[model samples]
Target: MAEAQREKVIRKIEQHLRKTSRQLIKIDTEEQALQYLSDSFRAKLYCDFVGVVFVEDDLFVPKTWSGNVNEVRDTFPLRVDHCSKQLLEHSLTDKEVGLAVDECQLFSLLKKAGVKTWFTVPIKDELHTFGFCMIGFLSYVPLLEMGKHFDEFGQDVAVAISMTRNREMQLKKIEGIEWITKNLSIDAPFEESIEEITTRAGKGTNAEFACIYLYNDYDNCFIYQPPSYGEMKAPKQVRIEHNYILKEHFPFLEKTGGNQMTIPISMDLKTIGVLHVERKRSGVFMDEDLQILRLLSNHIATILENARLYNNEKENRNRLHFLLEYQQALVKETVKHEGFDGIISMLGELFNESVVLFDRFMRPLTYTMDREEEVLIPQLRAEAEKARRKVNPHIVLTEYSQTFSIWPINSGGDLLGYLAVRMSGNELNDYDQIMIEMARNICSIQFIKQKLVLDATEQAKENFISKLLVENVENHESILQYANLFMWDLYNPHRVALLSITLRENELEGCNLLEQQAKKAVVWDYIKVFAVEKTKEILAAMFKEQYLFIVPAEKGVQEFWPQFYKDIQEAGKRSGIHCDILLGVGGKTDNLHDYYASSEQARQALNIVQSRFKEKGYAFFEELGSYTILHQIDNEKTTDLFLENQLGPLEKYSQGKNMDLIHTLRVYLQNNGNAKSTAEELFIHRSSLLYRLEKIESLLESDLSDAEVRFNLLMAFKLYDMRGKMS
Candidate 1:
């Protein structure tokens, strides 16, 4: 080459390099720097094509190009074989090397574009070569002398490009961090914030996709949180271990051969989750990408922690407010004396659930939310028993295709009943629990108040009834006036019933005096309920442990008495109460003043059941044929004198013995002197009865063949049986 031409080429190259340096000084991004580099080289150097190839996965990938290379642009990326390897080696050693179509296969694309030769210059920093800047020529040009001058210029170009790339990368890191920080400052929802963080991290790291997986503490796993923006597909859940890799947890991802970076989102030294980014065929992430992701992960952790705390506080506040409102509503209801019905109505309305009020016996008394028939008393009682046995105050029973949350109503440790809230599902949130608890407490107070009123009213009724039945009060006008106050029209004749109840030992066992008394009250409640159902209209009162019911003298009374007894038995069994019931039905009275006579008849009949009529649960006063006659002879002294005269010696002799001569003689006479019949009735052999008969005759000093003697003995035995049962 001539000296003047060389000087002109050198000056033109120098001028273009100076202008490129000035253009890059104003550039703030890497894309603009690379585009200007290609354009400046192609236009200023008069080259047909200028392409910037970056090292990607050990291949030279053309990232940007200028001028005429569109025909072969799709196949521009070339693998680093021996030919391209030689060119890279020379470029990295600070040599600008030229390539011909025959010299290297990488130059074949330029040849196809009508270029004869192409040469490469390395873009590098002090320690590493990032890529090569390739210039292609369409015509043959001598490059031996030009290559020397361009080599020195290539060093300056490399420095400028490397500096521009680094500056742009730093600016992007700042912008990404600032963008995430600004979004975090906004009061967006937790999910929205998470989406923003993932988006920024993906963009900042230049990754193809990004996503987050939140650590589930309860499940001890990581759950995928799908961002609204991202193309990454991840598993819904993963059982993560310490130092986990995405491909290890999800093996299907391994086939993609992509680069994955997982950064732990941490708060207070605890890893809450992971921020993950993936690079498909784009290649691996750089160290700067990792640093930027770490900062984003930290911010995400902060947002998550804040959201957790905020949501918890908001929930607590809402719960407290709800409880206060519920308590206020209950207090108002109580003040108005609306009782159980109102309380359940409020609960049903507020919770949109069914509510039932049960009596202490677990019987459904009132219900709200149209759930009257659904409240099964038998199931409720069973659940209540379980709760009591388990020492749990509340229990949930799921049966009959429904669920119920039962809160026991107790006052002073005495369980009143239960407030049952029928649940839509089996789970109860803390708010539901709080509301139910408050309802239980309110019901307990109402129960105590109702008990106080009931006790006072019950005491008055008992006093009036006791005067009529036991004291035989004779003030007719005054008695009628008092009866009217109890809604009883005693002007009509009425029959009296006496009840003797013996509770099973287990029901009262391990109970204190008050507890035992409470149990008795519950039994009384059950008896009252059944009695009213049978009689339709009755005036009843409880005294000591017995109940006295006064019903109209209707023909159904006969059936009512028997069925009432049977009903009590069945209910007791179903309600888990084991007991014995002895009932006595008295004859109808003529008037209110004659009620005392009927009551006395009922007493005598009940007495008969306790002693002689042991096989039957109830007895009628009019049905006691012999006992009625004996009881009608009210002169106790005369009956006693006759009893002593007839069988005093026999009774004195049989006092401590298992055999009773008086009973044996009575059975013998009552059976019409047929000893065989008497023996069969007594469950003994005839010889045993004959011997007892001989013994009784010997003791009484009378012959067995006298009808007068036998009659007198029968009378004495009847008195003896009646007297024994009465005592």
Candidate 2:
């Protein structure tokens, strides 16, 4: 009968062991494992009180308990020093069966809680003892009365508990291996793997909440909330410097909150963010549970890292493909399509961003924004300019969450403009830069091709005109026919002003050198429209190096002349050539032959200005008063006189080393007669500058308020600038 009972007990223990093992396998987190152990032990062990106490330092702290367990767990402190020396010694000696029942502090507590018999088992893994599991029976049965049955029951329970733990450890190892294999595969997205990690963690541990907070280096914050969670209940973002989560917040775990067990998730010594798990039930964690969480954490980290790399690689490939296609399309297309609009639309579709292309001046050329009108085009332009000037190319506009890139277009060393693209979405990477360069190359080629075609057509027309005029054999009707052709080709409304510059005889070493230089420097297409409907000598080149060119009057040749002179001077300086310019404005004329007389008068006027202003570097017809008065003004003498009269006192004071006086005068002038403003400007106490000013007024024996006195001082300040004596 006893044998049958023993067999039945063995059968029951085995069944319970299997059930507990299954429960442990379902445990996703440490908290769930604790709860499972507590519940399972209480119901199966037939104990009035069941509790698990984790060893902290040298003391066993109650982590999970049941049936008024909180009362004892809270008040009773189980120190290893105060407990059974026999049991403690046995735990140290025996690696497997660290179970002991003795009269100790825990036993005393059980006695007080109306417990008669108790069994204590050390929950351990391969290495060290993690904690002790206690099962207390309230009955006061004598030791001899139930010795045989007690021994059998106690041994069975210990074996079952140990088996359950072994299974949990084994399962955790399997799960870790499986997760690593699956996550390391190239098919997984980073976010998907992270989600799987967190989800599996939550389910396996039976945690109420499980989250992996990733470190955001850009924001220097933690992103704990997943996208599916519909935004974090916490602020949209939290700074790491302000609200750092520490291990102390988790009371169920040891120092650093199970950090040792969670080393894998913590990333092998680089734990920037936390992987947190919580339970609704109190004391829902065990050392074994922590171990599982730690293992799982490692898998989570690996998966997250892999996923991030995959995402970056994927984005790079996509960007490259988009750029290749866009560039190919640009090269193939010839018509002047909607410049950046089509490009922006294509980029938007390809890169998943609202793109805007701006000109070199920052004006928006084309955009793909939802609210184009609301977009701050000017501000965006300013930002792009500022970024180009002050920051590196890799910088992103964090305030607006936008990125900027610039590309310049040039044809034959002449800058046409720049292409500026503003994109929104992920920050631009190296791949984005490569793609932008590709697009820029395509745009540059197209711009150059179009410019070449236009230049070639204009040159052909110019050549035809030169050939006809040189033959000197065309009749009036033939010349008129060519003029009519020129008028039709140069479509804009135009007027003519003939300019003739007489080169000194033999002064230029090379014949036709000036004309050759002019041909290379001046844009012919721009000049042709200038001579529309004027004279047959629209662009006349005489053998004496005296050239007469008719330019458009209404096309603002007046404004162009100043810049033209500057360009000519620069070109002349570079080529070691010098020539005088004689500009004569002919009245606006519509007929080609009628302006010949006006052109003659302009030539004569240019000669008069050149002869009269022989010593001057530049002589403008408008600057010559009455078109004849050219008086020489000695600028050096004038500068000297002005400096001696106006800046004499300041120079004398500076020579005398009266720095206080010099500073006071400067402040007074800057302040515009306001004592307070002077003091503020000098960063001195108001009384100090005022006192200095009063002393100067007293010493000079002059009323500073007097108009004449102030005027003299102002002139002195002005003269300081002329004399270069301000410093």
Candidate 3:
């Protein structure tokens, strides 16, 4: 049996290498060659089964002949993973065939098949093991000399596997390069295309992980896109200072310990990105893999650079086309209502980018972006405010990224507001700047038209209010008709509130007129709120130096009046406007005639508020319980004569002697004849105050206890204080 087996082994080696070598060369694919060898060697080697494994990838995938694939593959104990320790021990020393039953699980499998011996011949060259072939026999004799004799057959199989694997590797590398370079679309999603290239490169080079790190001119750093099988969220970005061509450490590799290889991806021999691949488990590597990786990196870099250039050319073409179309549309579209609405819409449609239009007050007239729904109101408001503060009328591009460019819009030397162009990629170039400048020029016409319409409407509103306040009430129907024409709710009960703001002379000292105005108006916030109030439902206007608010008198609105007054007065204080404020609230009046009456009374109450109270800045006509009677007497002669008849002698005496009699008499009357309270009020001694009071009585020639005299003297003191400033 030994002699027969020796002869059979010799014959099989000669036939497999010499005769089948020509057939193996004809095989075009690795799978065909593997299957052909496994099936042909089973019967010739006198074995129950045969299996072939080749190292073309990170795995030793076995091609089995003659049984269930899993059952056959599961029995092998010399697989790359199962025999890795033993293989390393024999990496250079042991390369012969083996039939050790105690060392392999295949022994049990062979026993079940009634086989007594099993042989596994490693297919390897001097440098590395390409693959191995395994065979099991029933009742074959164990020969010590056959181990060395099988070396010839093993060498033959190793040569075949090496040729197939090398051919496959070259073809795969070429295909990978071509796929990435020629197949990817210029309009494809840039990040997604990059990820696909990384995945293909990993597969081509037998790497467990792969990544593409591209240069970001905006951040001045490298951004990593990790492999799909890796930590998906990992390496979204990293700040790598050095270029990939130089030896720089990747911070992402610190946590993921592995044997890694990185190649600089270049376009026209200039590195712009990096290609990184790693083996996580055992760092399976080869010279062929590194060579293929280098090729892939070059291909990926060229693809990216070409795609970027193509996209830029396409974008420029689109922009030029849209500019011409927009100019045509702008010239054709006439103003319907709020003439700027159409222009803003055109701006959004043409740009296909983030475009926001703000008025001079930093209030958004209209806005649109790439993803408009994702934008927050505060972000728009903040960006608009920033654009509003820039003094330059040309486009101002921010540093680092070209995503945002702010252009101030002006016409006839008056700044209207700003046009902000924002996007996601490269900064605004000269073409973008020129396009925006033209956009601004075309848009200014609408701005002027809107302004003209606004001015006409404002003039009409002022005319209506002036006529309502000053015209004769005999033609009240004509006045109501005119109010209805301006969309004013004249049928409802309306009351007017006047907010008078005045600045002291010195408050405007260190500031220019424009700066002073800006300070007084609170710049952005106050102007925004005031513009809103004027344009929306509230009927407000800037008349003289006061703000006029004509509003509906709804129920429970009176509760807000106190806080509203405090808010405006606090605004004045904060603005350094030293404002003297007097708010006279009119009573509710139903008819047009009574509306005129209410306004007249409101004016009268405002005129008398200073004379009635000392420190009160506000007065309500309904709450003026005793002062209502005082507000009725408007004749200056009556007031002058009353003051003269009552306190003329005391005034003369006080001026002549510089005594406290007049003051004491006034305090006593205010105190209702209580000397203690009167002295406390005057901050004097009670006995001295009483002496002054008696002296005053002796001069007036009247009893100190007369109720009629007390009443007349109190009225005289109030008139005396309001002598000159009364209106």
- Arrange candidates by TM-score, descending: 1, 2, 3
Candidate 2 deviant stretches above 4 angstroms: 1-171, 183-185, 189-192, 203-208, 225-272, 280-284, 328-333, 336-406, 411-413, 421-428, 431-435, 475-485, 488-548, 551-727
For model 3, residues 158-180, the per-residue Cα lDDT tens digits are 56666777788778777876786
TM-score of each: 0.69, 0.49, 0.46
**lDDT (C-alpha, whole model) for all candidates:** 0.72, 0.54, 0.63
lDDT of 1 by residue, 1-727 (tens): 5888888877877777677767776786667888888988887778788888777777778778897667756675667662456454444211233334455566655556676666777665466666777787767766544554455555666666667667876876677668876777435777788778877877776777788888888787888887634675667688865745645664433132337777778788777788878764366766667777777777678778888888878879987997798889888898787467888788778778777788776777777755454546567667766674454444555555666677778888777887777777767788778777788888887888888887787888887776676545666666666777777777677888888766678876887887766665666677776656566577778855567878788747466666767876665554456667777778898865577788878888887787667567888888888878887788987887888878887778888999987677777787899988999989998898989988888877898789898778777766775675222
Enumerate residue pairs that collide in model 3.
402-427
lDDT of the structure predicted as candidate 1: 0.72
Please, what are the lDDT tens digits per residue for candidate 2 over residues 1-727?
Answer: 9878777776676667567656665655555676777788788866677776766656778777886645567765578777765442222211122244244566556555665566555555444455666666666422223333333333343444565577767877797678668655557655565566666665555555566666677787756646322223333344666555544333343323332222224555676555656552323555556666677766667666666678778877886786777777765553456344565566556555555555433456666656943355566666665664443443355566666555565566655445556555336768767766666665566556656775675555555444433423345565555557556423233333334433445544465876655633343222222332133424433322334444444445556555554553443333223444445443444544334544434443455444443343333333434332212223656656655554445456557564567557766865678988887777889887767777677656667777797776765543443233433
Choose 1 or 3, whichever is better by lDDT.
1
Going through the candidates in the order shown, the clash numbers are 0, 15, 1
